[model samples]
Target: MYRYTDFDAAFVAERNAQFRAQVERRIDGSLTEDEFKPLRLMNGLYLQLHAYMLRVAIPYGTLSSAQMRQLAYIAERWDKGYGHFTTRQNIQFNWPQLRDVPDMLDALAEVQMHAIQTSGNTIRNVTADHFAGAAADEIADPRPVAELIRQWSTDHPEFQFLPRKFKIAVTGSPNDRAVTKAHDIGLRMVRNDAGEPGFEVIVGGGLGRTPMIGKVVRDFLPEADLLPYLEAVVSVWNLLGRRDNKYKSRIKITVHEHGIDDIRARVEERFALLRPAFIGVDQQLFAQIKPDFAPPAFKDRDTAPFDQAYSNDPVFRSWADTNLSAHRAPGHAIAQISLKAHGATPGDATADQMRVMADLAERYGYDELRISHEQNVVLPHVHKADLPAIHAALKAAGLATANIGKISDIIACPGMDYCALATARSIPIAQEIATRFDQLKLEHEVGDLKIKISGCINACGHHHVGHIGILGLDRAGVENYQITLGGDHTETAAIGQRTGPGFSADEIVPAIERIVDTYLSERDSADEAFIDTFRRVGMTPFKTALYGESDKKQKAA
Candidate 1:
C-alpha cells in the first residue's frame, strides 16, 4: 500500500511517455520487429504466440481496491475479458494489441501500478509472502524490505542488463509461503538472539532444467545492511556470472559453478565498497514506507453469524476449512479466494470476478487484496463476521472454489497455449487432473497436495518445488509428461526427484491418480498429508505405483 511520491509519479510518467513513443515508432515501421524486441521487453511487453502479452507488476502481490478495479478495466477495455495471475505474483494480459499497450500502461500508472520490471533481464517484480502483514507467525512485514528492493532495483544503472533475468523474494514468516528459496536472492525476515530483526539471506536456489536449493549466504544480516549487502551479492554475480550461454546465465548457475563460500567472500568485498553509497537514504525511505503498512483497524465482533453459517451451509463450511488461514487479530481471518475453479483455467480471473473482488475488498477486506504465488487471490484481513457475505459474493461471481491446498489447487504455467517457448501444453494437463479429482471427490480425502505443472523446463509453474511436480516435454513431437515426487516449497525446501518414465498427455492424469492412491494407501492415516506421506515413505512406493516394479527395474537398467 505504498503510495507514490511526486518523484515516483513523475518517473513512471516519463517512462510511459518514452515507451509510448517507442511503440508508435515500431508501428510506423521506423523500428522493425527485431529492433523492437529488446525495447518492448524492457517495458514488460512480449510478443507471445497469438498476441502481445503485457505482464503488470503487483508489487509484493499487494493491491488496493482501486488498483484492482483498474486491472479489471484494462482486462475489459483492451485485452481479453480476463487476466492470468501468474506464479510470480504478477498478472498477464495475454491478448493485448501492441497499439493498446501504451494506453494500458498509462491507465496502470493512474492507479500507482505499472508494467515496469515485470519482464526483461533486469530485476523482475520483487515478491513477498502473500500474507505479509496479516500472518500471525510473521516476525515483521517483509513488504517493507521488498519495497526497498523495488526502489533500489528499478532502473538501477548497474543492473539494467545483467547476465540474465534476476528474481528476488522475501518472506516474513518462518513457514516460507513465498517460495523464497527458489529466487535469485531470497530474504527471510528473522531476528537474532539479541532480538534485532534482519534477513536470512539465501542464494543459488532456483528451479529450471537444473533445480538446486539455495544455500544460506549470511546466517543473519542486520536490517541496516540489507540493501548494501544485496547490491554486493548482485554486483558479484554481474561481474562473474556466465554470459556466453543463455541457459547457464542465471545467478543460480553462477552460485552453483562457484562455491558459496567464494561467492560470499566476493560479496563481502563488494559490500565494503557499496555500503557507504547508501548513506542512510534507503533506511529513510523504509521509515517513510513503514507507516503505510501499519495493521488495519480490526473491529472486535462476535463470530455467532459465522458459526451459524458454518453449521447451516456445508458448502461454506468446506470453503472456510480449506481456504481460510488464522489471523493475528481475534476476529479476523485470511480468506484465500481460489482462482482454480474445477476444470477452469487456473489463475485466470474474469474481469467481472476482478471487479467483484475489488468491491469485496473495498466493502469487507480493508480495501486490500493479495495475489498468492499459487495463483489465488487473498483477502488478507477479512473479519470472521464478513466471511458469509464474502463467500456469497464470490460464489455468485464464479470465483468461489472450495479447494485451496487440495489436489485441485494446482499451479500451472501458461504453456503451449500462450508461451512461445513451451513444447507441450500445461493448462490442459492441470485441467484434466483437477477435473479428474473433482469427479472422484477425492481432493479433501487426498488432503494438502500441491500439483505444479510446467510446459517446459523453464519452471515458471515452479514444478520443481511442487509436492507432485509435472514437467511437460516434447519427446519426438509427442507431448510427454514427467513426474517428480517429494518436492516441497516451504522452510524445508527440496528439489523433487524424477520418477521412472514420462507419461503421455492422456496418461498423465491417471498416473497422478495412481501416485495419490499410493500415498493414501501408504499414509499412516488421513491426518498425514500427501507431502508428509511422501517424505515418510520416500519415492519408492509412489514410483512403484506409477511405473510398477518391472518398469522401475527397466528404468534402473
Candidate 2:
C-alpha cells in the first residue's frame, strides 16, 4: 500500500498527458495503425482481435479500497462491465473504444495507477507474493524491493527497449507463492548463516514455446547489493540476448545459449563495475518505501463469531476451509475471493463484484486488497471474527466459491475469445472443465489441484506450471488440446511433461476427468493430492489413463 508522493502524482500526470496527445493523434488520422502500434503498446494498449485492450498494472498486486473502487468505475464506464485479472496480477479491459482509452488512462491516474510498462519489450510490472506482508512464514515483506525495482525499471534509459519483454517476481516466503522460478529474475528472500535477510536469485526461467526452470545464479545476494546485482544481470543479458530473432530474444534463451556459470561470471564482472555508482542510494529509497508497507493496525478481538459459524454452518465452514490462509498476526486470516466461480471466466470480476470486494476490504480488511497471481482477490489481513459476514457478502456477490486450489479453481487466459494470437478458445475450455467437475461434485474430492490452460504455445495462462496443464492448439483446422502432467509451481518448480497426442476440444474435459479418476484410484490414501500421486506414480499410470495401455506400452517398447 505505497502511497503516491507529490512527485509520483506529478510524474503520472505528465505521462498521462503525453499519452492523451498520442491517442488523439492516432484517432485524427495523423498516424496509421502500423505507425501507432509501438506507441500504443508503450502505454499498455493492445489492438486485440476485435477491439482495444488496456492492461493496468497492480504493483506487487496491492490495491487500496479507493483504487479498487476506481477500477470498478473504469470497468463500468469505459469498457465492458467487467475486467480480467491476469496471471501477472494485472487487470485487462478487453473492449475499450479507441477514443476512450486516454480517458481511462486519466481515470487510472486519478487513483495513482497506470498501465505503463505493462506491454512492449521492456521490463513488465514487478510482481511479488500476494501474501508478502501477511504470510506467516515470510522472512520479510518483498514489496519494498518490488516497488524499488518498479521505480528503477520504469522508463530506464538503458532498458526501455530490450530484445524481449522481461519479468521479475519476488517472494518473501520460502514456499514461493509468487512462482518466482518462472520469471526472468526470481528473488526468493532467505536468511543467511549470519542471520541477515538476503535474496536467492534465480535467472533464465521462462515459459512459452520453450519452458525452463530458472537457474540459481546467486545463491545468496545481500539485500544491499540487490539493485546493483539486478542491474548487472539485466545489462549482461541486454548485451548478450538475441535481437535477430524475436523467438530467441528473451533472457532465458540467452541464459540457455550461454551456460549459467558464464552468465554468473559476466554478471559478477558487471556488478563490480556498477556497484560503485549505487552506493546505498537504492537502499535509502527502499528504506523510505518499506515504512509504507508497515503492518496494518490489527484489532485484537475474540473469534467467537467465526468459531460459532464454523461449528454451525457447513457453507461457511467449507468456504473458510478452502479460502482462508494462515496470517502472520494472531486472530487474522488471509481470505482469498474466488473469481473462478463454476462455469464462469477464470479471472474475471464484474463491476458489482469489484465494488463488493472493495467495500469488504474497506470495512473489514484493514482497507487493503491484493490480487493473487492465481487470479483470485485476497483480503491479506482480515480478522477471523469477520469471516461469517465477509462470506455472506461474497456469497451475495457471487464470489463465495469454496474452490481455492481445487479442480474447479482453474487458471486460464482469454484465448481465442479476445487474444489475436490465440489458436483456440481458452475461456470455454476452462468453463467447461470447472462446470464439469462441479456438477460431478468431485472438486473437494480432487483436492489441491491446479489446472492451467493456454490458447497457444505462448503459455500466457502458465500451463507449464500446473499440475494438469492444458495447451489448446489449432491442429490443421481443428481445436486440439494437449495435456501435461506433474508440473509444479511451488519451491520445487518443474515444467510439466506432455502426455502423448492431443484431444479434440470435445474430448478435453473428459480427458481431465480420466486423469483425476486415475489419481483417485491410484493414490495410497485420500490424504494424497493429485500432484503427489502424479509424482509418486510418475506419468506411466496417467499416460495409460490418458492414452490407452497399448499406447503406453508402445512408448515403453
Candidate 3:
C-alpha cells in the first residue's frame, strides 16, 4: 500500500481542520443549508433521505491492515455499527451525523485515507482491478498509473468543476474486471505490435438515463504520454460538454452529439499543447511508486493442511471453490471474503467483521486487503497453507457466505433506504432474492450467475451489466420492477435487453424463480451457465418464461 508522505499528511490535516470549522459554522447557522451544500459535497458528505452519508475513498481499493482497523473504528463509533462498501470501491457511512463528519475525516487521515474528491464534480476516486498486482494474468500492476492519476487530478484547478462528475478506471489484465466500457474514461493496459506496454484509451462510456459503452479514442498511447493525453481528453470534454441540461452534461452525451472523429481531433490538438507541461515529472513519480507494490515475500510451505481441510471439510471446500481466485504466486490464492451473507445486506460489513478482516490480513495476508467492485473484500495474496485458519476466522465473523459468483452474490445500491433519488427500495429486494435462493439450495447448481439491482436509473448497482438485471421503478405511485436479460460485465461486455412488462414487488421473486427454472429446462447441460444459454438462444425464452407465450403471440398479432 502507498504510504502518505509528510506533505500528504500535512495537506490532509489542514483539510480536516478547515472542514471541522466549516461544519461548526453550518451547525451555528452562520451558513445555511443552501450555502453548505456545495461545501459538504466537496468533502464527500451528502444529505440522504434520513441522514447524512459520508463516502470515504479507498484509493484503487488498496488498504493496509491499520487502515482497515481505522475504518472499523469509524463505523463502530460514529455511524451505525456497519459500513456499506460500494460498487465504486469506496465505503459509505449511511447514518453519519452532520457534526461527526469532521471527526470521521480526521480519523481517516490517520490511516492515510480521506474523503476528498469522492463526491465532487472533480475526478472521483481512480479505480482499478481489485486483483491488480496479484492476478496471474496481469502484465503490470495498474495501481502505479492509478496513483499517478490520483496525484494529478486531485484539486486540479482546470478540472475542479467540469460539466459533471468524471470517473476513470484502469485494468492491467486482458480480462475487463474494472468494467472499462462503462466508465467516463477507461484505460486498458495492453502491448503494442512492437511488444511495448501502453494503454488502449477509451472515452465517453457511461450508464445512466442514456447508457453507452465508451469509444476507443486511441488504440495505443505510449506509457509516458498517459498523463498529458488524459489531460487533453478531459479538457476537450470540459469545453465541448453541455451545461444547459444536467441530463446531457456528461462526456458520453458530448461524444454522442459530436462524432468520435471530431472529439479525437480536438483531443489531439489539446494533447500537443499539454504535452510540454508534463515533460518528466509524472514518469519520475511513477518510478517512485513502482517499488511500493512489489510482491510480498511468499513462503515455501507444505500445503498438507489446506489439502486435508479441502478433503475433509465440505463447508471449507465449498467456500474454497466459490470464494477464491487464481494468484500469480504458486501456493497462494486470492481469498474473496463475502460481505453478502445470505439474508443480509449485500455489501454491508459489520465493524467486528472489519476488525476480523484486518487482523487476518495482518496475520496471514501480508498486511494487504482489497475491496472489490462486486461489493466484496479481498485478501489478495492469501497462502493456500493458511486457508483453513482464515476460513474459520471468516466463518466466526459472519463473513463466510461462499457465494462469490453465484445467484445469491448480488450487487445492490442503497436505493430508497438511503438514497433520496431512488424511486423504490432496492436493499430489501436484494435481501429477499438472496434468501430465496439460499432456501432453494440451487445456487451452486445454477453456476456463475450475476443478479444486479438498482432502485433508480442512476444504475449505481450496475444493473445494466448483470446476467439477470432488475431495475426498480415507480409506476403510478406503486413500486414496479423491470428485468433485463443477457447482460455481461467481463471482457465481452454487453448491456442487457429488457424482457418487456414490469412485475409488482411481490411478483418479482417468483418471476425470477420462473426465469431460472426456464434456464434449467432450456440449457443443454449443467455446463451451460445462465449467461451462456441466454446468449445462445437470445431473449425469446426468458421473455416467454417471464410473461408466457401468449405475451409474444399478442405482440405478433
Question: Each candidate's lDDT (Cα)?
Answer: 0.93, 0.94, 0.93
Clashing pairs in 2: none
Candidate 3 residue 241 Cα shift, in angstroms, is: 0.6
**What is the number of backbone collisions in each predicted candidate, taken in the order shown?**
0, 0, 0
Clashing residue pairs in candidate 1, if any? none
TM-score of each: 0.99, 0.99, 0.99
- What is candidate 1's lDDT per residue for 421-523, written digit by digit as tens? 9989999999999999999998898889999999998999999999999999999999999999889999999899999789999899889989988888999
Cα deviation of 111 in candidate 3 (Å)? 0.8
Model 1, CA-based lDDT? 0.93
Q: What would the per-residue lDDT of candidate 3 be over residues 260-290, giving only the tens digit for each residue? A: 9999999999999999998799999989888
Candidates 2 and 3 compared by lDDT, better number: 2
Residue 237's lDDT in candidate 3? 94
- The parts of candidate 1 lying over 4 Å away from their true place are 552-557
- Model 2: lDDT to the true structure: 0.94
Number of the predicted model whose lDDT against the real structure is largest: 2
Instruction: Please give the distance, in angstroms, between residue 388's alpha carbon in candidate 1 and its true position after superposition.
Output: 0.7
| Candidate 1 Cα deviation (angstroms), residue 268 | 0.9
